[model samples]
Target: MSGLSIPIHPITHNPTEAWEQIKPTQRVIKLNVKTPTTPQNENMLRFVCMSDTHCLTSHLQFEIPDGDVFVHAGDFTRCGSAIEIEEFNSWIGSLPHKHKVVIAGNHELSFDPKFTCGPAARQQHKNAHTGGGLINEIPDLGIERAKLKAAVEAENTVNLITNATYLQDEPLTICGIKLYGTPWQPEFCNWAFNLPRGKQCLDKWDAIPAETDVLITHTPPVGHGDLCCTGVRAGCVELLSTVQSRVKPKYHVFGHIHEGYGVTSDGKIIFINASTCNINYVPVNPPIVFDVPIPPGFSK
Candidate 1:
């Protein structure tokens, strides 16, 4: 990703009017520091974050820096095959970070039974019933689906990634920081963690714990880092509302739409779309790194 300097919201005498002019569309600048470094007397937790690797770890051009924690927001595999999952797990195991947090992306079909067995089977049944009609219109995997199902059952049922804590709609605290990870996004191309817009999606987001300090999701909140190359904004509006109004996580990290790889902030929340791949699916985008100070008087 380009090290493009974003426009920061300047502090003004008129606080109310200044905030009103700071729209989510306005890009908030990222720290220009290449590596996370601690200043005097600050207990900063350095995080090395990358997402949407899509099984392209071998092609990565840059080195992942050492940090207190490593976060893979999602899309560790191109397809959610058991072999791919194991490979990603092995790679995660090799990383030097002490705490590694991973969340599933929309592509991780086996992680969600609703997509693989429940809805997929039901849709297949419906297609057969309706003289070859299609739901979601994603191509039938046929034998591939059968193979993937078996692989998921055998390898991914109990322990998918041995080295990292994989979370789905769950919160985990590491070194005094309360973090929540969720894979759900607004329905798009019918992938995993997809819920319909409005109530369905909003209800899922409503599950976010109010005290979350770090929010890891696979999709960018609307109007933040979700602008597609084609000019269409593919983000969850409801997610943005939830993040801004209620959850208000200090840092929100995600990746799915590869084109939307960068950092932005809306005063309170720093949104990082750390998509590791480019639009062409090359794992060339650099891992975004940053530091968040451990909250005062907090214990692990």
Candidate 2:
């Protein structure tokens, strides 16, 4: 009745008594209506995952399929500088995915002061290029660190990237699925999210909720997807224990060791190293895609 064009049924009564005397024929009418079907994507959530873009968005040689959600494990910029972060943010904003989730990595020095202040790790991994701010090779390392810290404080470095949902030791729920994201990883090259190997890393992993459906971390758990070309296991053992024993997420997505871009499963869980870039710092790897069915009895 509110200006909507809906079907209406009409009835009329005969006033004369002769109407009843006369034989009347019955007539029936049926109205057919169509109900719209829901979109196929509405029934399932598709996640397109990638990581370690390293300020090489435009150079990507692969196509990212349309998806409901996009997950970036981190290291989107070469040095997490204002320019780098801004460019990354623009690229993230341009993605067609409905929801985008991201976390900071060791290379994102502007996001973490401790990483920028610490001396560079003795070993530098492949494609770990240095940009502005804290450069360990400089003769005046202290002065460089101080200068970087001053820039971060003055400009609020993290504020530069605001296009995606940034997570740091946080959990979020989307489309009836629980997601927890943290950037922390085993201490390496004194980068952001680096924590000492033993209890420190364990304490960080402990914060992950037991019901996390999708776990997004910059570093993979030990022996899962943390293999480097140098024949070293850069993952944290405590993190692996926590994931296998307690968290047990349906999908553990990460990317830091570029050489470890692939997928693995441990009977119960699926581990995806969705590194979009390769060891040579080339953004040639394809984005990983997976579908998660809607939970039973779940409604929007």
Candidate 3:
């Protein structure tokens, strides 16, 4: 990371036009960065992204194309099992990318409880789900004590990948850029980072500090990279609005809707839906790569 100074996209123009050769369907494993490969430049950088892996260890172990940073959108596990979480984390931390950032998908319930409840929340939810019955008041299942115990066990016991483990609501800096991962998703049955529409998820994006170089999430925004053949948009509308309007990251990477694999750009932001798994739940998609120039003075 010390001597690595290269401008991934060097032309003084729009990146989409410069990298138009890249396709949404064609499989590409590498993107070459020009001579300057470090973050000292004013504006240039490269990032690698993959999403919806669902615990495909082979894809995780296979050599990922080179880049300055690696971003995983979400769904690292099939059921957020302790085994799957460790397996994915171990594999993700090993990539050549200088930094690795990830968010929890609907599958990893242990870390993201926004969409889940401990015994108390789960019980309260169960009561409501059972009959939508009116309750004198929502009972706090009081499962925190037990939940914390389980969470600690997972983080400590599960094997670690690169000494970097899953971080919640925390920011990690790589090279000179800032990276953040939010595991929240749209409202759905008990799932990881689940948030309701409107105020629920928007509140999450408000915490992202400005100049965030990269944002990682499990679900894509409504229109950009999120689409379903079911004639419905299954992504988070609030996240889309907040990220595109507020964070304005150089890259927004996500996966969950497998069919959304590909690249979409709003002229300023490059959206990569890097799902390692396909619609049929197969690890067919390859890692997508991009070169981003790190402007001089980019923070650590």
Clash totals for all models, in order?
Answer: 0, 1, 22
Question: Lowest-lDDT window of 10 residues in candidate 1?
Answer: 1-10
Write one digit per residue (lDDT tens) for candidate 3, span 1-300: 112221222321222232333234222332222223344333555677788887785754445777666677777766555666777776766666666766667666555543244564456455554543212132322324334234423543323434343545667777677777777776655455666665656667677666787777777865655666665567655565566566778877888889878877766777778888878778877788766666577733
**TM-score, every prediction:** 0.81, 0.75, 0.69
Best by lDDT: 1
Instruction: Report the C-alpha displacement of residue 228, candidate 2, in angstroms.
Output: 1.2
Ranking by lDDT: 1, 2, 3
Question: Which sections of candidate 3 miss by over 4 Å?
Answer: 1-44, 59-63, 114-165, 298-300
Q: What is the C-alpha local distance difference test score of candidate 3?
A: 0.61
> Candidate 2: where is the Cα deviation over 4 Å?
1-41, 115-154, 297-300
Best by TM-score: 1
